[model samples]
Target: MSSTTQKHRNFVAEPMGEKPVTDLAGIADVLGKRLVSHGFDRAYIVLGQFLVLKKDKELFVGWLQDLIHCNVMQASNCWQCLNDWCSEFL
Candidate 1:
């Protein structure tokens, strides 16, 4: 499968703990830096945003684009990662 798929699986398979935002699928170093600069340094922090958005894909995807100017594919990957993680853990 694709690298993003692997990333999604790996992210969803474990407790997020203090994993850096970069560990999340589609959050590359540059995007992760942007997110960290905006106070979303950890995966769990991003997850919090996902939860705050009520896990609505549109809102979360729009928020990511608005916040960091990420493309739809990246934001979608991140949303899917969080969704799967929630399904497995919460």
Candidate 2:
């Protein structure tokens, strides 16, 4: 039952070299801005956090939620986006 958005499709389609954090699925302007303010201004920085969390769904989702009050769906979408990106590029 898992699925993704066009955002997700576009993200995982290629190497995410130096892309903005907003380019990740579910990380729109507000979230991206917050992430940027926290010094996680890039996709690779967020990806590093993802790896630091060992790609664990619950941990990553909780981190996103705690960081910028993102909801479950948003966090999950971002997680899946990163996970899929890793599958292709990492």
Q: Count the backbone clashes (under 3 Å) in each candidate.
A: 0, 0
Worst 10 residues of 2 by lDDT: 1-10
- Best candidate, lDDT-wise? 2
**In order, what lDDT does every prediction score?**
0.92, 0.93
Model 2 misplaced stretches (Cα beyond 4 Å): none
Candidate 1 C-alpha error for residue 29, in Å: 0.3
Model 1 misplaced stretches (Cα beyond 4 Å): 1-4
Candidate 1 local distance difference test against the native: 0.92
Tell me the lDDT of model 2 at 48: 97
What TM-score goes with each of the models? 0.94, 0.95
Error of 1 at 49 (Å): 0.8
Q: What is the per-residue lDDT of model 1 for residues 1-90, given as tens digits with 9 covering 90 to 100?
A: 235577788888899899999999989999999999999999999999999999999999999999999999999999989988898889
